[model samples]
Every structure is written in structure tokens, then in C-alpha cells.
Target: MIVADGIIELDNKNKAQGSGTAGSVLVLLSTYDSRVNDNNAIHLKNDGNSGVIYAGNGKIEVGNGNQIKEATGWKIKLKENTTVTYGQGMAGLFFTGPGGSYSLVKGTYQAK
Candidate 1:
């Protein structure tokens, strides 16, 4: 899905699945004030299949300011057989944000 210049609040959990055994979540944010916050309270889970989540933006001020932009309260759980892929051009997924905490419950990770 696309969030051009707005707010995407994932209150509980957000999910996406593919046709068979593969699926993906692609987020593209333009050079506007677009933000995605999970309140550092939810788990974005990709389970029982092959899936990828790619969120990219020219400007993502994660943890540079307010609580909404901070990754201090972020939680991402990749169950078995799931992967969160990151590209050389992408920035947010590779960094440890505020709270400076990340726990890998399960699954495999790679660079693409």
C-alpha cells in the first residue's frame, strides 16, 4: 500500500499475504510529512509463509524527535519461515532506534 503524506497507525496488527507461499508489504513514502507508528506496543507478524516488508522514504526521521517518530516502542516479530528484507538504499530497517532494543524471537534475515 501507499501512504503519500499522512499518518498510518497500526493499532493492533497489520498483515498481508501472497497468492500461495509468498507475499510482500511494500511502503513508499514521498518527500512529505508521512509517518507510520505502532505505538511501540504491537507486533507486526508474518507467519507460516514467505513474505517481505519493504518501507522506503527519502526522509524518515525515526527517533529524531517525538514519540510517534521514535522507534523506541516498536516491535517486529518474524515467526518461523519469515523474513524482513532490506535494500542498500533503504535506511530505517537497519537501525536500532530509541529504547535501543530488538528481540529476534525466530526466523531468518538477509540483505537484498
Candidate 2:
């Protein structure tokens, strides 16, 4: 449960009349041993400037060239047969129960 929060900028051509949306994004991620939950939180740079990789609650094993997050939620990393429950933010529940990556078996999206 890695909490990553920061702002992003959209640099489009002048032809576009409407401006882009920019704000803080809180991203929660975790991975195992490349078999179950194996991998980095995020490895890509498309459209983002500054942010923080909040790894406080749980143990955070990061890769190279990582950013600084706000560090809040727990950095959870479960192994084989490990089950995790996902809760809500401040309103409706997004994810709950075991699984990995993006999975929606019972017709419900486990919040990202």
C-alpha cells in the first residue's frame, strides 16, 4: 500500500482551446516476488512533474530513481495465497478481498 501523491502538468499544443486538468494524485501500489506481487509501484514517465512516494506504515522496497512521496498508507506486499482487503477512501468502497494487480471478478472494481 504505497501512497504516491503529487501534481501533473499537461503540455499540449496552443491549438487546443481548453486547458488540461492538473492536481494531486494519490496512488496506492504494492508487489510481491515477481510471481505473486512482484514488480515496482510504477515505472513510467508520460505526464507528471513532482510527487512523493509515501512509504511509512509498511516496508518500502523501491527501485532506482524513485520520487519523494507523502508517505501515509501501509506498503503492503503479500505473497502466495495471501489475501488482502481493500477499503474505501471517504465514501464508497472501491476494493476488498484478496487478488493482485487489477482484478474484478464479482462485478466490482477494487479501487486502484
Model 2 Cα shift for residue 74 (angstroms):
7.3
What is candidate 1's lDDT per residue for 1-81, written digit by digit as tens? 343343333322333333332323344233232234323222233232112222333223222111221122223333343
**Model 1, stretches more than 4 Å misplaced?**
16-23, 28-31, 34-83, 87-112
**TM-score, candidate number 1:** 0.26
lDDT of each: 0.31, 0.30
lDDT of 2 by residue, 64-112 (tens): 2223233233443322332222223312223333542444557664444
TM-score of each candidate structure, all chains considered together:
0.26, 0.23
Cα-based lDDT at residue 1, candidate 2: 23
What's the CA RMSD of model 1 in angstroms?
14.1
Candidate 2 residue runs with Cα over 4 Å from true position: 1-20, 29-57, 73-112
